[model samples]
Target: MNILAIESSCDDTSAAVLAPTGVLSNVIASQSIHIKFGGVVPELASRAHQTTISQTVAQALDESKLTLDAIDLVAVTQGPGLMGSLLVGLCFAKGLALANHIPLVGVNHMDAHIYANFIDESPSFPFICLTVSGGHTQLVHVKAPFEHEILGSTRDDAAGEAFDKIGKILGLSYPAGPVMDKLSKEGDAKFHKFPQALLKEGLDFSFSGLKTSALYYTQAKEDAWVQEHLNDICASVSEAITEVLIKKLKRAVQQTGVETIAIAGGVSANSMLRAKAKKMADTMSLNLHIPKLSYCTDNAAMIAITGKMKAELGEYADMNMKPFASL
Candidate 1:
């Protein structure tokens, strides 16, 4: 089946075409307006999605050499994202499904992130995925295409959230996570020690304390001092976040006795995390799956493929499906 997928869950308006072989076309239009604000503005993001969604879908079909009639299924993200953004894509997809008499599927945003690993290679069943994104951080155990067991998740701010927040404190650009990741490679991770919150029991995470620690530490330093130590600061922050994540991932592996591990979501592109995950995989003698950089962030390719999986399972969403701000 040829599936058309739409993803407007946040500031990005994206569309993609998925076939049995793989994704044919994945188009994304990012809202640069958010960059100036140091964060996404929901109203602007929704409006931007409205403006770009149609053309984005058109482009996807065009690139794939397919038409609306070729789309057997229309899939869209239903929840766990900005409501207005989600609504734009949902309504648009619903319209297409109705007009074309196509099947409609609602995909969980976080679930799609985990399934992104399937785009390149299939991991064994009962695999573990560390999904680190701007809004969420989770350790998920995937037993099947749609079956998942969440082992650990963030208690407060997510790992990528911490990166952006810390980046803001350091006077970096909006969406500071990438910038921090880049600068982290240039400096010493051991230059400063940031607190890593380890949960006492099952796999759970807390980064709120780490963000606060960064705030207090930076405030104590003079502007000149901070500027000189920015690289080291970024490295230290990255280290703290990755350390907590790796430790929890190790625990999850040990508990589950699963030899397959993966990382997904936006922060999966982090150099430190990728390197550490590779090293961890080697040390633990586990198979590691990491998506290419393009698939790491929010995009429709993951949505399309995930939707195809749902469609194959005969899991369809009704026209009455509503958008959600969170799961």
Candidate 2:
């Protein structure tokens, strides 16, 4: 069956087509207006989605070399995102399903991240997934397909939030995670120690303290010095964050005895985090799964793949389904 999916979880408007062979085409239109604001403005993001979603979906279908008539199933992100943005995608999907009599699957945005790893390759069940994104961070124990137990999550600011908020303090772009990762390569992780919160205990993450430290640390520095040492500062921050994540992951592995591992969501695209996770997986002799960078962020292919999984079990949403801000 050909599955058509929509994703408008935040600032990105994306659509995709998934076929038996694999993902056929995935398309995205990103909003760049938020760069000057140093953060995504919800109203602007939703408006952008409204403007681009149709074109985005059409492009996806065009690239897939299929028309709407070939789409047998419809999937859309339903929750844990900007409500207005989510509504645009969900309503569009609902309309398509209603018109075509296609089965509809309302996918959780976070669940899509976990399943993103499944799009390209299948990782065995009973594995742990470390999902780190701008809005959330969690260690989820997937006992089997569609059966998940969230072991732990962020008590405060998520890792990606810390990166962007701190990056703003350091005079970087709105989404500073990518730029920070790039600069980190040239700097020293040991340039200066940044605090790793709640590292001695459970799997819960806390990046709020690290953001505060970066603020105070930079505030104490002369403007020129701060500018001069930007790379080193970014590296140090990445070090602190990635260290805590990997350490918690290690503890999770030891506590749960799960051998297979995976990382998903935007922060999973971080170079340092990937490196550390790889080293950990190698040292422990465990299988590790990481999605292609394109799958790391909000995208419809992940949603469609997750929808296909649900379809296997005859899980379908009705016309009464509605988009949610959190789920």
Candidate 3:
């Protein structure tokens, strides 16, 4: 079956084609317009999606060596994102499905992130997934395909959000997570010790305190001092965030007794998180699954693969489907 998917959940406009074996093409057009704003602008994001969706879809098909007629299913992200951005992709998918007489499937953005790990390699059933993105930070227990139990989530700011916010304080560019991760690699993570938030029990997370701590850290120093220690500061921030995440992941593993684990979403692309996860996995004798960098961030391939899975189960959305802003 040929599945065509569109993902405009946030800033990037993406399209992908999925086949029985795997994804054939996954094209992404990132919006550089939000750089100056230091964050995503909803209106600008929706407009950008409108401008790029058609060409993006065409390029995806071209890259896949397939035509619109080959698309048997149209899948789109339906919720838990910017409403306007979600609407652009949802309406386009619905229209395409109507015109082509193809099946339409509405996928949850978070669910797609978890399923991303299945695109190339499959984890065992009942594995734990720590999904950390700009908008969300969650630990989910996947019992089976399409069946999940959210073990824990952020109480306030997500880990990625904290990263971007702290980066702004350091005068970094917008979408600062990647830049912060890169900068951390050149400095000492132990140079500055930041507080790690723990819930005292269970698996929930909280990064709001960390962001506040960073705010005070920057305010205490002059611009010159900060610039001089930028790399070390970034490394310290990365250490603080990843330390909490890894600690909770280890606790969850012990509590759930699930040796198979994975990490998903954009923040999983952080070098420190990846390295730390590998070390922890080895110590615990756990099987770890993490998607490639391409799959870690928001993309259409995850949506298409998820759509294919739902299609096999006869899960379809009709003309009445609507987009949502929260999970």
The per-candidate count of clashes, in order, stands at 0, 0, 0
**Which 10 successive residues of model 3 have the least lDDT summed?**
195-204
TM-score per candidate, chains pooled: 0.97, 0.99, 0.98
Clashing pairs in 3: none
Over the stretch 1-327, how does candidate 1's per-residue lDDT look in tens digits?
898999999999999998887889999999999988899999999999999999999999999999998888898999789999999999999999998899999999998999889987989998999999999999998887778999989889999899999899899998999999999999999999999897456799999999999999999999999999999999999999999999899999999999899999999999999999999999999999999999999999999888888878888899999998886
- What TM-score does candidate 2 reach? 0.99
Off by over 4 Å in 2: none
Q: Residue 162 error for model 3, in Å?
A: 0.3
List pairs with backbone clashes in candidate 1: none
Alpha-carbon shift of residue 94 in model 3 (angstroms): 0.7
lDDT of 1 at 219: 98
Local distance difference test, each candidate: 0.92, 0.95, 0.94
Model 2 pairs in collision: none
Clashes of 3: 0
Please give, for residues 1-327, the per-residue lDDT of candidate 3 as tens digits.
Answer: 999999999999999999887889999999999999999999999999999999999999999999988889999999889999999999999999999899899999999999999899978999999999999999999999888999999999999999999999899999999999999999899989898887466789999888899999899999899999999999999999999999999999988999799999999999999999999999999999999999999999999988888988999999999999995
Model 1, position 97: C-alpha lDDT score: 94
Highest TM-score among the candidates is held by which one?
2
The residue ranges of model 1 lying beyond 4 angstroms of the native Cα positions read 199-201
Which model is ahead, 1 or 2, in terms of TM-score? 2
Q: State model 1's lDDT.
A: 0.92
